[model samples]
Target: MWLTNARVFDATGAAARDGRAILIEDGLIAAEDQAGAVPDGVDVIDLAGRTVLPGLIDAHAHVFATPPTPDDGAEPLWPGLTAHFVATGLREALRMGFTTLRDVGSYGDEVITARQAMRYGAFPGPRLLTCGRIVSATAPGGRFFDGMYREADGPDEVRKAVREQVRRGADFVKVMSTGARSVELEDPHPAQLTGPEIAALVDEAHRLGYRVAAHAEGLAGTELAIRLGADTIEHGMYLNQRPDLLDEMAAAGQVLVPTLSCYYGVASGQWTAPLVRLARHNLAEASRTLLAARAAGVPIALGHDWQPFSDAAVELIRLVEHGMTTHEALLAATATGARALGLDDRLGTIQSGKVADLTVVDGDPLTDPVLLRDRAQIWLVLQRGAPVAGAVFDNSAAIAANARTAADSRSVTHTSALSNAGRPRSGTTETPG
Candidate 1:
């Protein structure tokens, strides 16, 4: 297929170029140039005046979760309905221009099943990488959330739990380093896993070639996780309190997946007064810490921690509100996120030989980034060179059929060894290329 007449934003720290043409063959990008000529008999897709970018990635996601109700406490509200909830979230994310989703934690292998189904063409959705279940201690986590955790007691048990996830085909390991504040179920500031236990789990996961993601909110927990070498830190709310620690994180190249939308939801009055008062302090801390981290050179990636998949774009806006240019925020959702998930070489940027996945929005995000939060502005999405969702074309069903055929015929590897890079920046706009 030939895509033409669009402004192409490569998301590779390069300035945007106008009127470029891209060619896709066999689900991979074949070529791109300012005025490329197309071979005869190839299909043509005219993008009008829309802007093309690498498809967005959500580094921390939960495909099986729905919007939380304050009334629904610590357990699964609806039993045996996991598949339906997960499918709904995945479809909605794809329609909103996210082509890659990293599901950090879910109750079971539901995300694994979803990944295979999406790969084989059973449905239309983003590429999926999941950590089967979160490993936690039996004392605090197992007693409350039995369905979502594999509760174990010590270093030996934690190592075993990490192995259990790998045996279940988990792409990575997720451990709860500390309690959560939003749920009010456990101590929010104390470390749940001891240094030795965390070290044991990390050793096992890294030995098996999988990255580890830690749910760390407070200073004590975040410090322990960073010291133990976690690949990514989730909900780093207290990072501002220790700028020195932020510098350490920068030196170690640890990626931060701050889900600030969680706090914003509370401040926006999504919940009643009691919850609002409970969430305000933590929200303020998250806002301040995010700006500090950006200033300190920690790599940032966009991750919408829960439901209302459209809210994923809000993370980008929050980064800008804190202190980031629109181009930097765009790179967070695209290239930076891909790096965090270990899929950067294949999916992040719009260059030759990468998979042909692109998102075309109606307006220039560099000028008005909030437009990304509006689903109406997301005009088209192409996954692996197939038009899966859009205002112009809907070839998802056809793409699914092809995906199934491909999966059956070959063994495809979606997971990669974890790695990190130094801080990256974007280029200022100049004369159109």
Candidate 2:
């Protein structure tokens, strides 16, 4: 299959190239060639000069239902219902142009089950990589987060916890190196685990050939995780307070997933005053940390640790607003994210021999990254050379009819096909609402 006449952004932190075409065979990118160099008898899908990008990746997300609030007076959903919500959330993520999601935490084993379901083709969804449950020390967070935390203490216990997650089919391991801001009983500043415990956890995970994603918020814990060789730091918002750690991360090739959207969510919501205050403070510090990390050459990846799977693109816009360039932000969501998840060799950029997962947008995202947040602007999404979701698939009947009529007139055009696909074009260059 040939995807022709498109502006291709290979997600190499570079500008888009015009009049390019991609060749796909057996679910892999075969080659890249000039748009006008297609051989005869090849199936072609013209993009009408639209922007094509590597499929986006979210490195830190939760697929389970959010824990209930005390004021809501509702019990947690049943296990089966939780699984259903996980499935729906994953499917929604795929429709929004995300081809891969790395879930750092989820309730029980629902993430593993959802991964199995998607792998078996029970439903169409993005590729899933999960950490079965968050490994936390004995703390108030275990009670606050319910089934999401796998509480353990001591070096031996933490090592066992890592093995347990491996046994549960986890693609990676997540360890809480510090307390959480959301739980009022817990403080976000101090380290939650002892040095030996965290060391054992990271060592065990690495020994097993699995990457460890450390949930870090405070400077003390952030330094520990960085020094202990955590593969990725989940939320190193206070890293600005410790530039030395950022330097170490840059040297060690550790990726930082700032998760800026989660702090924004908490600060803007009707949460308790203290939690909101902490969130606002962390949000500001995170902005400074982002700039410092960039200066230190620390790799940053996009991770929307918020709800509503469809709004994942908001992280890209947020990254740009914080300090990164639009091209840098796009790379954060694509190449850098894949690197964070240890899948860069197979899934990040658009190059020969990589997996054929691509997203087609109606306008240039470098001009206005906000267009990625609009569902209507997602022209087409392909996963492994197969059309999975997007405006094109949603309006296939109309597109087919228009193609037939255009063929009769001998004036078929990709623009007419897009018009029939019901894509909204007027707001493609608009700013965020």
Candidate 3:
């Protein structure tokens, strides 16, 4: 498949050629050049004045569990992961042009299921790397009952916990280096993991051949993870507040995945009162941290730690609004994120041998950064040379149809329910008032 006549913008910036074409063969970008360079027999797709880019990547998420966690109490495990919900979320992600995502945690086995399905093509989704769960301290504010949390007091337990997650099929290991207001479910200000404990987990994870993404939010946690050589710092929201920690991270060249969307849920009043209060302090800290990280020369990647894929993509735009240049934010979602997941060899930027995960939008994202968030302008989302999920967004009706389909499905679900069991059946369907 070849896409031609569109603007192409990526890590290299935006460029327009009269009739340039991107030929995709065997899921890798085979050739990109002037039109008809690949021969007439090849499938040619024309993008009328749209902008094309590498398919986006989300670095952090709870892909298997959309709602994040349920209101379960004292359970070692949260509700299990279902193939259905994971697949649906992946579908939504792929439809939105995300060709790859990294799940920071999963409830039960859902994320693993989704990852396997996508890898095997049973379900269409972005390429996935998954962390089974975020291991935390026993009394840590972020502990989630019995679900994925494996409580550890010291280095010994932390090391064992990492192994357990790997045994459970985790693609990578996530160690909650600090307690944050968000996951506490109660406590907003939490304690940081000891350096030794964090180092233990990191050492074990590396030995097992998995990259480590530390849930390092507070100053101490961020510093500990960076000093110990953890792969990436997830949600270094308070690293800016602690100049020493920021400098250390910068000096060490640690990558930062600032998940602004996590605070978005709290500040947006989407969470309960306690979580909201926790988010209140976090929001400002996170904003400041992002700019600081950028200034300190810390690598910043786009990781929508939010539940669904759309929210993650929005974080890409938010990164720009905060401090990142359009080019920087795009690189975060593509090259930076791919690097964080240790998949840079395959995914991320556009290159001759890289997978042809590409997206075609209507305008240059760098010039008008808002174009990155314009779902309607996304004319095409291709994975491995195939048009997957919803049709290209360039077709106005396709966009409207997709939107209407969502609304109609929702309307039917909420307003089209049958009469109550004991009540008389109504001849007409009751609509949402």
TM-score of each: 0.85, 0.90, 0.81
Candidate 3 — which residues are off by over 4 angstroms? 13-19, 34-40, 64-82, 140-145, 183-191, 393-433
lDDT of 2 by residue, 327-425 (tens): 999999999999999999888899999988899888888898998998888878878876677877667653343221223233333323233334422
* Candidate 1 least-lDDT 10 residues: 424-433
- lDDT per model vs. reference: 0.77, 0.83, 0.69
Ranking by lDDT: 2, 1, 3
Q: What is the Å distance of residue 55 in model 3 from its true position?
A: 1.3
TM-score (C-alpha, index-matched) for candidate 2: 0.90
Determine the backbone clash count of candidate 2. 0
Rank by TM-score (best first): 2, 1, 3
Question: Per-residue lDDT for 1-433 in model 1, tens only?
Answer: 7777778888889988888888888878888887455455455555556789899989988776564456756564576566766777887888788988889877666787777666656667777788888988754566566567887778999999999998887888998888766554677677888889889989999998988999998778789999999989998988899998889889988889888877777867878787787668777888888889899999888888874786678888888887788888898899889888877888889999998888888878888887787777887777877666654333323222222111223332221111122110111001100
lDDT of 3 by residue, 345-388 (tens): 77776778887778777667767767655566555676665565
Best by TM-score: 2
What TM value does model 3 have?
A: 0.81
- Once superposed on the true structure, which residue ranges of model 2 sit more than 4 Å away at CA? 66-79, 397-433
